[model samples]
Target: MQVDSKAIDKFLVELLTEVGTRLREDSIKKMSVATKKNRNDLVTNFDKKTEQFINGEIKQAYPDATIVSEEGYGDLVKDMSGLVFFVDPIDGTMNFVKRGDNFASMIAAYIDGEPLNGAIIDVMDNEIYHGGKEIGLFINDRKIDNPKNLPLVEGLVDVSAPMALANKFAVQDVIKKSSGFRVYGSAGIIFGHLLTGKEVMYMSYLAPWDLAAGRVMCEAAGMSVVSIDDAPINMLESQVVIVGTQKVVSEALKTLKTR
Candidate 1:
């Protein structure tokens, strides 16, 4: 059965718009914060509440669809066989808890293990980057052109802070090949820059929700989405996600191997 792309996109836009507005409004007040894996890795009340709200909405709309969310509200999805919605209600929870900016809400829908549609809402900027297999990438209802295929040496690359700090996967070498490096602390926002051509490439160790939605948008915009080792991404697990033009990906991989 072919899913209705237009209908899915419309529903997602409405859902994400509401999520973004609520998150922005909530940021002004004090939030309850707690740690998950470690002290530096934090989660706020809004993250749990937002994920619950989104999960409820997804269930109401499509009960059969399985949700794999960052928060504990989703199911333990073993595979991406049927309808699966990956949700990152707050991609940058630390940023939301501290800076209250540079965070984003991302959701991607996959059917039969294939990306069907994806949406990333830049809450601070009131901009939405969304697209699917049927409809191309769009920002706030306007169709945007594909980003230029700039080389690694010509443009800035966004790297995860931890990756750069630890020199993981010889990312520092790849950074030197670029004009410079940027650490946004949020995969969704970094992906936004990659889609708009503000950053030529982005590489990080990311979870499924972190890269799921952005993967759809990046591929739709004529960009490359692959592992740092030059392999296809596994949508159900964490991996080193690298997104950029072909030239940049090739160059970055070569640099990592040589290092």
Candidate 2:
């Protein structure tokens, strides 16, 4: 089937903006919450509610598109085939629940397993980082260029707490080679930073929804999104991933390759 990049980009931006507004409204209210894997891994009424909304809208707008989403509202996708959409109603659920900020809503579209476009709405920041291979990159309404292909020593790296603390993937070695270390606990927001050149690198374990929008946006902006283990990028599974400028990725991959 023929895919329309312009149509998809327009739909993604419009839908995410509508969803972001709802997320902002929900942020201030008291919502029921429950634990998943651990106490810190949470699911809220808003999370499921928002995901259902997005999935429903996607189905209505593009009936043939299969959705992969957090909160169990999506299809049971077995492979990255056909027209697919990935949705994270709240990318930083912990941040959204505990702090009422720092979270985001994300969606990305892929056609026959190739990225088409992605959009992330930082609910608090009110900025939507969007676009992909076909549309270029945009933050809300403004078009932007790629970040500098900076070396690892010149910029700070965002490391997940568990990865940094446990020295997972020998990430400490990667951090040491960089200018410094930081962690924001949110992949979408961190990816936004990477797109704008606020940071040079981000390393962490991310599920499909968490990785989808960021991966599309960052890669489209000329940044590198890769798996250090050299596995093919799979959209249906969780894995350790890295996103950064091309040069920084080369530098980081050298250290990660040792693991």
Whole-model lDDT values for every prediction:
0.87, 0.86
At residue 252, candidate 1 shows an lDDT of 82
TM-score of each: 0.93, 0.93
Q: List the residue pairs that clash in candidate 2.
A: none
What candidate 1 gets wrong by more than 4 Å, as runs, is 31-43
Ten residues in a row with the worst lDDT in model 1?
33-42
- Tens-digit lDDT string for candidate 2 (19-111): 888887776544443443333333466788889999999999999989999889899999888999999988877788677777888999988
Task: Give the number of the best model, judged by lDDT.
Answer: 1
The C-alpha RMSD in Å for every predicted model, in order, reads 3.0, 2.9
**Among all windows of ten consecutive residues in candidate 2, which has the lowest summed lDDT?**
33-42
Work out candidate 1's RMSD over C-alphas.
Answer: 3.0
59, model 1: CA deviation in Å? 0.9
Taking the tens digit of each residue's C-alpha lDDT, what string does model 1 give over 133-212?
68988988899888899999999999888888888888898999899988889999988898889999998889999999
